[model samples]
Target chain A: MFPTPIQKRPVAAQALYQGLLPIALIMWLLPLIAVALFSIRPFSDFGAGNYWGWPSSFEMFHNYGQVFFNSDMPRYLWNSVLITVPTVVGAVALSCMTGFALGIYRFRGNLLIFFMFIAGNFVPFQILMVPVRDFTVSAGLYDTKLGLVLFHIAFQTGFCTLFMRNFIRALPYELIEAARVEGVSEWRIFWYVVLPLMRPATAALSVLIFTFIWNDYFWALVLTQGPNAQPVTAGITSFNSQFVAQYHLMSAGSIVAAIPPVAMFFLMQRHFIAGLTLGAVK
Target chain B: MSVTAPAVPHAPSERGWFQRNRMTLTPLLFLLPGVLFFAVYVVIPIFQSFQISLYEWDGLGEATYIGLGNYQELMTDRAFEVSIWNNVKWLVLYLLAIPAGLFIALFLNQTVVGIRLYKSLFFFPFVLSQVVVGLVFSWFYLPREGILNGVLAFFGLEPVNVLGDPTLATYGIIAAGLWPQTAYCMILYLTGLNAVDPEQIEAGRLDGAKGIRMLWYVVLPQLKPATFIAFVVTIIGALRSFDLISIMTNGGPFGSTRVLSFYMFEKALSEYGFRMGYGAAIAVVLFLIMLIFIGYFLWQMWQDEKEARR
Candidate 1:
């Protein structure tokens, strides 16, 4: 609206704008495009000094197979899914309840508690890192998917609760008041009346939590040590070390490590954008 | 009209003490699991780290209580100074995202064909993992054959070893970081620009305001919320910048690029004797630095909430 719409713009300016868009897009995505290109490039091409040239032969299929079959990539991916899925479900479900409580209740310390969750959400992870690792070890949950999942669920609850409470608070209170006046049980009122109405918030939160837990690198490093429990994010780091100068293989693994979250984003782009742009709009 | 319908009959027991008090208890019941987990994993650790900082341990055997020794050492440890300074540099450089994003937003705000696709394409960097960003940029900055060097060579200049030079390593990583952050800021500004008051723009135009004058006098003021969020997130991202530093240099070129987060990790986790206590002390310092921004942000949010309530 600010710049005149292209259809209404002068012809020369319009053509120039149209021409630059794709070029700009390519430059913007140059790194990812390079990675994709490098992943298919044969190892021979590297020593041959053909880094950016056309690939001598396409090894894309071989690279994918070797990454998935030979390396611990599949196992790492399973670890990611194992950690992320439960964190998403558990965090979202917990936040829904906690959000309802905080939003609807007229209790003392309500704002204080809400602000604590918000503040805790912003606290540096390093403060929690050492003691958390020690606690995980003592609990004998070290290097286990369960440990990562529990910690993620806890940490994510802070942000998810804040989002959910604000969302639920924005809903009409009359619905709950009507149910209460009819002597409906509080639990029933929440489940039968409120939850069904919270579908959009749930969807937004699920996609969000899924991506955050999946891409989490620091916690994965802290809790999991080996392929037995390491998620793809941390595994990629170790993989980089092993595949030093093996850019093709490393790039392929990076692609694999990125797929789940990328897939989630594309699949739920609307909700994902909605979740991220929450505070931006208002 | 729909409210005139007959009310559903209620069982007398529904008004009993249990039913009447259920509202008060149900919320607490709902809150328990999340609160318990949050307190155990997040809240308690802050205090635990504070306590751990008072001691000396390698995370095995017994921790020796050594009050202030780690802090004392940090006072003189050159690497600590280097990492802290790099973090400050990061914080300052990262602020470029706001203005960069706004300019890009202005450039791309036109309703051109495929503009939506363009926006998303520009936003792509934010989606990729920092590991991938670091890897790609490492290649991009790789001296002789790197893309940047190749471009420079085309212009008859010698290749610059951006990452190899201790002075430039932090800057190189900061540039990589800016690519994504600028994209994020662009998105926020795009959203803000969408909401800018058109009437105000027309009014300014009638008053002969144009270009930077119009933007500064009229448009930028309306973008306050977007700018605030961009500032806060960029600061947090800059302070937490560990992945890029780790993957790119590993605090290298003579330990010149260690940010606080990566430095703390090196102390705690690596086979570097697992100095958990010293690591905790470093973490506490980083946490306190972050708390400054967090406190200001919380105060701002409180003001916003109060205004909303009013």
Candidate 2:
């Protein structure tokens, strides 16, 4: 309502506002749009230096098929799935119990533990790079999907705990107090009472973590090596290196690597924003 | 699982010490798994990394403790100097995203038809990984075949190589980084706009305050939380700028674009040979730079916690 709505302005100004919306969007998304257009073009388009011109032929199916069938792209995509899903489940599940304890109970050292998670969540990833890699290597989990999954679960728990704790803290304390007075065991209280009410935070954190771990390149590069364990972000880079000058194919692979997170964003836009803007509006 | 209706002190005399101290023990039980993992993977490693910084070792060998040796070398290292300069540039320029995002959010904060779709389309860049953003931008800046050069050529000017220019490469990578970062800031601002108090705005309007003056005096204070969060994330993003540099320039054109994060990776992991201790030293420097912000954030959270307790 700030600055007044365009509808409240003159009719010509309203018309102008609507007309400029798409233009601004197109200009903002110019690079992504260009690649999206290139993804459907044939190899001849780039080889001939016909970069911005209309493609000589549409090769959408051919390019995407080449990415899917003629490469380790499928394997890398599978690796991404293997790494991300378990991290989401592990991080979310771990954070729930952690959040419940930190949020519901007032005990000695509670704030210290909660602050530890909050602080760890924001430190530079580089600080963890060498040690985490060494730790993973020593544990014999190096170059494996499980290595990446375990490291991600541990790293992501920091942020997830902060989110889940804040969410659980905001719930009415009376419900928890009433349940506690009935002498329900602590685990039963968490399982039946707190866990049921935590579904929204869980969904929000799950989608956010899925996108984050799916799109992760630093850890995928640091903790795992080769197509054996690398996620699509790193894999697609290697794929590009192999098929150099195949910008069309590269664009297609980029789109392929990007699809899952993009789809998740569209499908879960509200919850994703809720998770991201956890501290913004408040 | 039945709720205990008859509360006769739960027959406390019959319980063992474990059951008697359940209130104190239960929270720790719930916290054990998460705490163990966090302490092992996150907490312990921070100390380990700090310890490793004092020694000299290849990743696979015995560490020789030469206190302050690597830090002494860093005093005159030209690459370290450039990386630090570039980091400063990144930190300063990335702040542009906050103002730019606020501008865009104000532009799109309207009730036009199909506005939601427009907003999503604008936000689409943030969903893609920085690797993809880097690739798209590298191609976007290509001298002959890129859209940027194509546009210059269309204007009857010679094409300039952006990524290949030593002087411009750092700014070039920073621009690519700002693309997605701006989108992220815009989303935060949009959410902030939703929560701005309308009554204060009306009060300002009644007092003859309008537009920029009104925003400065009235609306800006309300957006403080959003601004604070946006600044924190932007600072962290600036310091953690590695993926795009890795994908786009690889610290190329004579290493003009190397930030601290990339330089640390190069020292620790790349084909440059794993000087693990030296890399740890660099990581330690980065960690110290980050500690300033981390300290501020923790202090703020502590104050908030105190307020909540009160």
The Cα local distance difference test for each model comes to 0.87, 0.90
lDDT of 1 at A232: 88
Model 2 ranges off by over 4 Å: B1-11, B155-157
lDDT of 2 by residue, A1-282 (tens): 576778888999998998888889887988888888889998887778899999999999999999999999999999999999999999999999999999999998999999999999988888888889998999999999999898899989999999999999999999888988998888898999999999999999999999889989999889878999999999988899877888889999998999999999999999998888888876
Location of the lowest summed lDDT over 10 successive residues in candidate 2 chain A: A1-10
- Residue A90 shift from truth in candidate 2, angstroms: 0.2
lDDT of 2 at A136: 92
CA lDDT of B135 in candidate 2? 92
Off by over 4 Å in 1: B1-17
- Chain A TM-score, prediction 1: 0.98
lDDT of 1 at B176: 94
